[model samples]
Target: MKRPSLVLCCALLGIVPTACGPGSDPDPGVDRGDSSTVDLEHLAITVSGRAAVFPEAARLLEAQGQPVPSLDGVVLTVEEPLRVGVSDADSVLGQGGIGADGGFSVSEVPVRDIHLSLAASLQQEGFVRSSTIIFDTAFTRTRPHTDIIDARAWALPNAFHDALTRSIGDASIRAHSGERASTLRDAGFILGRVVDAAGAPVAGARVVLDRDDLAGRVYYPAPDFQSATQDGTSATGLFVYVHSGTAAETFSLSIEGTQAYLPRNAGATPGLGLVLTLYPGNVSP
Candidate 1:
């Protein structure tokens, strides 16, 4: 079957998928053009935590009964005026290197919210660098004197956002109370199914969920966070996308090969699931 054009999906969702193309700024809410101009007190932001491999990558390993990847040696960078998503090359505010103990600290940071980007190189000889993981939550100063930022990157299925938020919250509380914060680990899931006009399962359909605010930043399931699906849909036309966070946020859904589907676009919540139905009809090319 011919794959449905993504352009159509974008149109149906009332979103321009390419609005945030390279070199284009999609976030008008905040000005992140330059971090040097921001006049803020320089505060120490100490980050300590484990940096695990991408959830999706770890899922692949677990499926094959392979040992889970380590969280050590991950390089995390903090950026100011948080962007919609992480880029390969972005201006850095501070950086920390995760050690064998899964702890690293960056000091002398401006008192403000920051975007944290986590990246690491794989030990495999063939596959070297891993994709950078950015959380939806921004790390902000919880207290005036508190600079210690406690965090953790775990291999939890569909819980990165939740874990990060919890960690940040705990760190903020600790900073206020002048105590050390503990690590965080939480997860959430998104279940979905694609069916045809006659209510029959439509296997091999591609479904994607992305933040409405971040035009180009797409979220996927664990073990394959980069790809919505490693293989096509299941025999039952069911697919589940996981994330490490809460489901209070709204998201836009896009279905591939939707030309055969009647109502392709559906509303989605982070932890909640969605169902898309296809009808036997001729769609425009």
Candidate 2:
């Protein structure tokens, strides 16, 4: 079979393209009952990573005097992108549990030139889940990979139930915090990256929702939250938007400015974990 162009694969990760080369199908280094796609030579890969609530969320919780959730029972998984409507059961490349220090090291993962995504979730209630595209070159068995996985909260943690009893006088902190936390739970979370045709990160790009109705409902999390209105994505070409509106909402994204890339209108649902890798002038795949 003909392989995807290097530009395409690199574009998906927002990495600079090295050159085009022959490779097998973009099958994840997973055993999905398709023995033909499994390359045993690449199975010794080791991926170590840390899982913690994002700084913004952590600060917010700390300010509220709530402790960060324990890392016990947290699970990390290495996975490959699957087609829409496809079951993920067959796409798991590897999985590991987080330690007390919120660290994880998963070995024996299948890695090649294959595109992969790392996902971390807490089995505990009210903790936000996280999934990010590797956003770099393909993982290779020649070396170990280290990653930091930042998680956040989407629901009103049971620990914060005190907010429900506070009077309307504390709306700014109590209500606002509750609103931000619940917004991520009810609506969804979106993480995006913009890249040029050659796959380098585009620094000044701004991602926007096409819906006029969602004007105030969209919010940027802390640290870089304020930057969303000023400088847009940084050199990393990363931006995050979460819904603070009522009900689950579905929408597509459009980038402002005169870039050659078209907006992705594939009905992205944030609750399902959307990590977008945008390429200029090419949105087909």
Candidate 3:
């Protein structure tokens, strides 16, 4: 699939991608220090939450009216910086996978006023190795840590909620101290599918979303176009784009290939789903 430039991709998503380079801190190894001698003022944080299955997989399950697959193999990582007199050091607080019951625990996390980063990863066949990150989670001992997952409130398609809830049960997770709860009101996403003239799934097509107002452009199989080899086309021909913008915005969807699809101009909304049928003729973007 042909890819667009990074600047164009970030603009479409309306996000400034975080830069990682040689000067950046390395992964914080898991902390396993004894808790007995820890300062009495610090509290151990316990984080539990559910993982959403892959988007295409969720859609397939929904179409079949089957139960969403379990996230038993999904892994969750929690990290916070170790602060010195002035500098902060890299340190991983805890990491674990979701249990069969859909719950996960990261015990004995040291209490600190730090920027917490939580990430969840799911690896399974027929689905891309997917991972989502929530950064800058403000954590404190005074705040309830039981609902850590709820606090992150990563925007996900509504169709995936059933499986997520079944895996993690109860969506009322807590946020770290001084953090605001994530609500659907602050969410935005785009769902779409590509098919050939015969209505069969089309894989390896480059999908792009260009903002109507020239605000930015978003490219599918993101991070870079070359990564598309690994992130390209799901088994179901479905593509999902989740962003931090409001649903009120508008965008024009484009497919980079010899053929063109219908309904090029689309509304960017929380649950908007677009079905594009490829034709034989090429259309200019």
Candidate 4:
């Protein structure tokens, strides 16, 4: 049997699917133009972290009893204004070489910009990088200093190539229609992880949005990449959702279609990290 289209699923459930038509602009709230420039202090700081192979690929290999790939040759560049994990601006802070064990550090780096500090994955030909962690800087009074980054990338594994092909297909369609590629960068984003009672990442569990209007605004990593499954959560348990408008949004979350989990009445906001824990379905949240 054929699977349902994501747009159709949302529409059937009373959620407005963004851009349901071919080359349609689903979200009007996304800022199509450049963000306003704000003058801020540039503080030089140290940034360091591990650049591991995408956990999903690793899991796929390990499950099949294959040797996992090494982190030896991947190069990571620190770029300013993390444009949804990929950078377009010319501003770059520094670059670090990954060790065999996926560990690296950059010292005396100048500027602690929001996107730059996340250790933007640079050119590693034939590899697609997943979104890295976004850390808060000194500008915010709450937990300033982001000196560490943990990131993952896929090395053209068959499964990843399949997903990439879907993404390229979507981009090709938009390009053919003369519409700029949609990355949802203008929309506010919420980054999160889902885990079970054992504190282990729940690979296949889906995070269902409670509100009807939030449909079609969420993506696994970003709008450009297509997830391998309709669950919209990656094998490593990361998920993201875009806000419908310019304002920050707080949305309720629940686990769908699984009797194994009883989700809490959790809430998440854009521009921050959220972790949702699931109790046993037989247990109370």
Candidate 2 local Cα displacement, residue 81, angstroms: 4.7
Error of 2 at 207 (Å): 3.3
Per-residue CA lDDT of candidate 4, range 1-285, in tens?
Answer: 142243343233333221133332211111212222111233444455566655555665677676765658577665433333232354456777877877776655554333212334444544433334333221121211323333232232444434433543444324322343333222223445666655566666677766666644444542335433344666556665544323333334566777565333322222222222334442212
lDDT against the true structure, each candidate: 0.36, 0.44, 0.37, 0.42
Q: What shift in Å separates residue 28 of candidate 1 from its native position after superposition?
A: 23
Tell me the spans in candidate 2 whose CA falls farther than 4 Å from its real position.
Answer: 1-40, 81-85, 112-123, 135-183, 192-205, 208-239, 242-270, 274-285
Q: Is candidate 2 or candidate 4 better by TM-score?
A: 2
Candidate numbers, best lDDT first, in rank order: 2, 4, 3, 1
Off by over 4 Å in 1: 1-40, 80-90, 111-148, 154-285
- The candidate that achieves the highest TM-score relative to the unseen native structure: 2
Q: What's every prediction's RMSD, in angstroms?
A: 18.9, 11.1, 19.5, 15.0
Tell me the tens digit of each residue's lDDT in model 1 across 1-285.
233343343244333121222243212211223222212244333434355654434655677576764546656554421121222243355666767776665655443433222221122222222222222111211212233333333333224333332423444324322343222212223334455655466666666544434222222222223224335455455454333333222344556655443332222223222222223442111
For residue 238, model 3's alpha carbon misses the true position, in angstroms, by 12
Decoy 2 TM-score against native = 0.47
Name the weakest run of 10 consecutive residues (lDDT summed) in model 3: 169-178
For model 3, residues 130-239, the per-residue Cα lDDT tens digits are 33332222111122222233312122334443332222212221121012213221233334456665556667765655543332223233221112222445444545
lDDT score of residue 154 within candidate 4: 27
Q: Whole-model lDDT for model 2 versus the true structure?
A: 0.44
Q: Give the clash count for model 3.
A: 6
